[model samples]
Target chain A: MKPEAPMTAEQSLALITRMIDQAKGNVTRNAFYFLLWGWIVLIANLGMFVLIKLSYPYPFAIWLITIPAWAYTMYASFKRQKETSALTHLDSISGWLWITFGVCIITLIAFGYRINFQINPVILLFCSIPTFMSGVILRFTPLKFGGVMFWIFAIVSFIVGHEYQFLSGAAAIAFGYLVPGYLLKRKESQ
Target chain B: MFDELDPLLHSQLRLAVMSLLISAEAAEFTFLKEKTNATAGNLSVQLDKLQEAGYITVEKSFKGKKPLTTCRITTKGIQAFEKYVNTLKQYINK
Candidate 1:
């Protein structure tokens, strides 16, 4: 057996600092999830925009793509959980925020038609909550700004006519998801 | 007067491990090894010591065909770590 050496207080403190930094670095490796959802929501919004522009008989039907998107998200989350042996507190909080956001969205969609309100605006409003909270949790300024941008777009969507709401929704996703998602990926790579 | 540090967390490797675990919900054995730059044998010994002291919990399960070991800090461990840090602070201030 190797002899154990006692560590000085300074050395112990340094070791603790280094280990904490390492744990924080590990949290960024999961930035890919932001990219995944960003692309999905972006595509869905653009698709809906095109359908509405073409005067498709069932323009609203395009939103159904989100169903498959949700399914794929569930599958990906489970797969990720299986591959990793540990989760950070940050990871757990971020996951719950998104999950709660998902539940709110599904509830909104299910009951939206009866509320006499435009769904996209409400969705955009709801989107800001989790986006901002995630940004705060991750301590990433870009995400926080992205969340604020979504709120601005949400108000715009509410003021504009229903036909133009899709465009606003698309813009919200662009700023809130795509931009920050790419930034996060770049930060992780560097 | 210098407060006594908890012996279980006084060593370099164990303290480093506790520091990593303090912020995380849990961590894998591989992660600990990678962060600590310790050999598997050495890390296993240190982790066993921590587990025996009730500072951490080790769970063994199979991930597909390979065996997996994950470690999580216990509530007792958190309190001990906090006390250790506070004691260290006192020493530094003195």
Candidate 2:
């Protein structure tokens, strides 16, 4: 009998199909993990900002805490990308870091311009528009949801102004990032 | 019942490589190798197979003087994956 030709294209294609399903599963799980970590960082960063502003001798120095937080986040993200070969994992972390960094800078400016500035968190609403669009582009639900939360909270925060900004931030962290992230992780485990 | 499963995806390593590429927007050769736990020579061979089959598209470039190979799933690959899952469902359900 003739030696069997290398596996047929149809066969290979079939195998690749199954593989994609597995990959999709992995991608979703990784997305969740990134969101969780993102929520953690957001909560910690905002909490620190509030505490320093209220009680610390030098509140401005407190924002420096982000440097270490960023370093840790990047390190953890890099390791996960290496271990899983799941590009979505790294992408989610990188995307969120960019979002958070933007938020921090804007907040700093708001604080600096306190007397002259209207202290409008309303500006933050504009920020989430592009981010939400990006989530649709990436086709990841968690990031997409996070983006929407940003938009929704932006409106609420702006309506309430600085009075309820911290509470808004907390709610955003919970619904936008934390819950979604944990659910993704739980689904993957199943 | 088992006949419904796609024969191509039956290989262990090829399946792993495709799985890695599927999750990534793009993946480098080294990334695929580490994730699949395959040797460079072996991984390259399997990648060539996927490329030849048109299920994946590979791009070669130099990253800071180092050779880099990146892979992404083609549209054809995506369709094939969906069909394969349906086939798998038939087998499992049976």
Candidate 3:
């Protein structure tokens, strides 16, 4: 029979302490990302409601259905565990897709109708700034780098071309959120 | 000369959690619990220790009226992690 090695006091305490640190990190990151994404969804959806109301007749009825869609997406996102690596990326992408679609619809409606409201791409561009900063704060290179790309695209769209604004939003999804999120998920799996 | 890492931050389970969190923006209690395969009571206890050490901060709030607890690493914690890694590298290189 092999002799069991005695665990040192230093070893045990160090082990316990390390676990605690990690648990704390996990809790913090999840909460921040969830809130960040949730707010983005809410803002996008609310924008959608406003545009739909202004552009179409009988807006309240549409708002009712749109609210449910938003709720459903929220439920799905919250209920989802970090299961399959691919699923996690898919979920983020899909959520961003909803926000992108909502934003694009509103933009189209507002621009098409020539509503007096100036479509300030700058405001939308600035909104993404924090997300990019969050990526930097976390020190994840993929997210940080991708965030820069999103920021660049945002700036370009606002300064150069309003026609590509919606496309910029889609690009944000592909690079900033989805791709890096997927890569992280893959690293986790490995 | 690099000394050994403080034993307090060098345990396997703790190291695993920290490693995961180092890469994450934030993660949930459940997520950490599942990943580390630690019991709820054990994980909670460990988390409190880290919070007490000033290596992390804990936030207690309610989500939809359900009690929600979250954690985040502090600057102090990141520094300690880096130092610990450097300490370990000394042994490997030596």
Best by DockQ: 1
For model 1 chain A, give the 10-residue run with minimal summed lDDT. A1-10
**Range of the 10 consecutive residues with the lowest summed lDDT in candidate 2 chain A:** A1-10
lDDT of 2 by residue, A1-190 (tens): 0112354445555555655554554442354444644565466547755875587675445446556765775677666654543455446655575567567655766575765543335444544554455455445576577778877886787677563575676676666666656665676677
- What TM-score does each prediction get for chain A alone? 0.87, 0.58, 0.46
Highest-scoring model, lDDT: 1
- Determine the C-alpha RMSD for candidate 2 after optimal superposition of all C-alphas: 8.1
The count of backbone overlaps in candidate 3 is: 14
Q: After superposing candidate 3, which stretches have Cα over 4 Å from the reference?
A: A1-71, A74-105, A115-190, B62-67
**Which regions of candidate 2 fall more than 4 Å away from where they truly are?**
A1-13, A31-62, A86-143, B1-94
Model 1 vs. true fold: TM: 0.92
Error of 2 at A110 (Å): 10
Clashing pairs in 2: A11-B8, A12-B8, A15-B9, A17-B81
Arranged by lDDT, best first: 1, 2, 3
Write the candidate numbers in order of decreasing DockQ.
1, 2, 3
lDDT of 1 by residue, A125-155 (tens): 9999988888888888888898998999999
CA displacement after TM-score superposition, residue B29 of candidate 3 (Å): 3.1
lDDT of 1: 0.84
